[model samples]
Target: MDAIVLLRDGLAAALTPGNLLWAFCGVLLGTAVGVLPGMGSAMAVALLLPVTFQMDPTSAFILFAGVYYGGMFGGATTSILLNTPGQASSIATTYEGHRMALGGRAPQALGTAVIGSFVASIIGTLVVALFAPTMVDFALKFGPGEYFALTVFSFVAVAAVVSGSVLRGVASLLIGLAIGLVGIDGQSGAPRFDFGSPVLLDGIDIVIVTVGLLALGEVLHVAARGRNAPDLASIRAGKPWLKRRDVRRSLPAWLRGTALGTAFGPIPGSGAEIPTFLSLGAERRLAKRREQRGGGESEFGKGAIEGVAGPEAANNGSAAGSLVPLLGLGLPTSATAAIMLAAFQQYGLQPGPVLFERNGDLVWTLLASLLIGSVLLLVINLPFAPLWARLLKLPKPYLYAGITLFSVLAVYAINASVVHLVMLIGVALLAFVMRHFGVPVAPALIGVVLGPIAESELRRALAASAGDLSILVDSGISLTLYALVLIAAFIPLVSRVRRLRAERRERETTGAGTS
Candidate 1:
């Protein structure tokens, strides 16, 4: 009954003309950035953070909610049409989306992706609304040791699972930790890595680093690569239409993907990308099994509609799921969620159990806005698919030039400091180097965001136990978190071995055929 009242009030608040206008604009901006390669909702929110500092928190979050939904909607647009994933989560979609495009099923592919995202987003939002309170209760039980263990689990899971190589991921994480350490220590009065500069004493601003690494770094990298944009001239950009057969195949896949994605969302360090891959893998295996049983024709690689629907749903579902921890525990599990956490802090608000009690209106309003934005995204994205495709044809130099300029202005606007510009350049350069070396950047961003919390919690837990290290493992929650971390860390290794064995078997079979 309380949930129902809140939802009613939330709908009333969110439906105001001013808030609705903000939601529309946010989704529009999010879609624009989402259609562009290497730009995600994270960059959009980061750039808007400094600008929205003085704005009302509820309205600002409404704008952000629109952007979040729009990014998911528009990401699939580029993946299907240009074969270039606009964001990391869209990578799985590109595997089959582009092939479907190449096979002249672009309309069907686009239909599946957009509709699938809508279904998943709805399911995910409902899950959040229903389960967030429960998670808050769970979070209220966490001790310092448990929180510390959770952070460790996040660090290890991201490092081991996201990157192509665990070593590179750890290297990126260490870089973030180093960045996180530069500010003044909260427990002590002393600065750690200020290097005798007053400006450094405040530590690196999250806004500056976020904009520098994601926004500025992308601009510089694109410019450095020179004139090789993919051709979208041959791509179709029409409205997506689904036949009965297509719907039949897509519905089940969409549900399955939503389940997998939503389940992974609350787990620290596991993001949308993982669920999409898992969804795709499951769909592939299922399709193969169907074919083996002589049940029906399987389109495993050649424009499979299941491929487009399932992974896209998973991607959007996980995107929604990431909010669970952010709202309930004040923990961010993805780059976009991390930026949103920063936004919460910027507004002098902390998201957790207390947020619900003290700021119930804001929480419910934001949730209501997510649902509104999801609808807006579906409405806007469907008819605007052709327009979004045209976005890819915009001159790269101009597009990136605008991004570069905005990034500079946003960074300088934060503190109006020349030092920030310098820091932006330095961080952009570091990001470029990391990208060049195939290093994963998400873990670095996560580390920077979570590092301080982990450090403080570890210290507090140790202090409570008189500096005894065993206090780290005292809680049942901490032990479970640690165990999960080990499992997450080794899953990749086990998968790699299984893959190698499968390849060996394939080779043996091929050899026998030759004989």
Candidate 2:
């Protein structure tokens, strides 16, 4: 009931002429940013932070949200047409979407993607709206042990699952932890890694690390690899409307994607891209069973409709799912989510516990706006998806140059520090090295961002308990959390051993039968 009242009031505010205009403009700008490759919402938002200083916080936030969602929406275009995901999240879409384009069904492919995303976004928004407050209460009671356990769990799950390799993920996380350690020690009042620089005493800024690793690193990586081809064209289908059967086949897939996304959305350290792939894999397994039973043949690699539908649904739903932790526990799992958390901080807003009581209006308003945005995406995109794609056709020199300039300006504006600019360049070089070694970047990032906070909690808990480690065992919840972490850490190796044993047995059985 309280949520309902809040929602009603929020809807009224968001729908006002001024706010609506802001929303539209945000969506447009966000879409444009999305059309450009490697230009993620975090980069877009970070770059715009300077201009935002003078703007109303509400309107600026609305624009940021629009850019965030719009970038996501635009990412699919390149994936569907060119098999190049504009951002990381659209990677799965390209698997089947590119095939659809080759088959001259680009229009349908685009339609399904847009529609699926819109639906999922709405579901995600609702999940945020309904569960955030309750979850915050649950998170607030957590002690240091629990926090540490959760942090470890996040590192393992995201690193092992999100990154290509568990070893590399752990390595990257450790690096982040090291970087995180480079500030004044909260407990001893002594600098650990400042190296006598006064600027280092306060610790590295999250904004600095985020922009350096994500934006500037991306630019440097592309530049180092030789100039990217200019004037690449995207799929230019005539329309973006789906066929009748698309709706029938996709509805089920969307539901499945939504389920997967919602289940994983609340978990920390997860990103939007993984859910899409997971959904695609789930659909394939299910589709294989249906084909086997019904005498249907596989159409998986050939633009199977289910491939498009399931991933699309999961991606959108997970986007919605992501809001759960952000709004509830104040944990920003993805890079984009992290930036959003930063935005909240800039406004002096904390996401957990009292957010509902203090900023219920803003929360509800955002939620209501999400519902509207989803609908608008459906209507706007189904017809205009190509116009969005045409952005890729623009001259390459201008595009890349613009992106580079924006990257520089955005970073410079954040601090106006030449030292930070050099730092950004150095990080970009490191990112390039990591890429070459196939090390996942996100874990390193998650580590750097979460390390300090996790350390703080651990130290606080230890001090509170007079350095007695037994307090880690005091709470049932904390004990359970640690247990889960232990299991997660070892589960992969256990599974692999079991799998290899089973395979060996199968081979032995086949040989015996031949004899």
Top of the candidates by lDDT: 1
State the local distance difference test value for candidate 2: 0.71
Candidate 1 structure quality by residue, lDDT tens digits, 218-298: 566666766653343555556567889999999999999999888777766556766776687678768867986997988
Model 1 gets an lDDT of 0.80
What TM-score, computed on C-alpha atoms, does each candidate reach?
Answer: 0.69, 0.69
Worst 10 residues of 1 by lDDT: 228-237
lDDT of 2 by residue, 382-482 (tens): 88766655555666556556656755665576569887677667676787788677786766767776687678877878888999988767888777767
Clashes of 1: 0
Which residue runs does candidate 2 get wrong by more than 4 Å?
1-16, 32-117, 127-133, 195-204, 211-366, 391-402, 473-487, 498-515
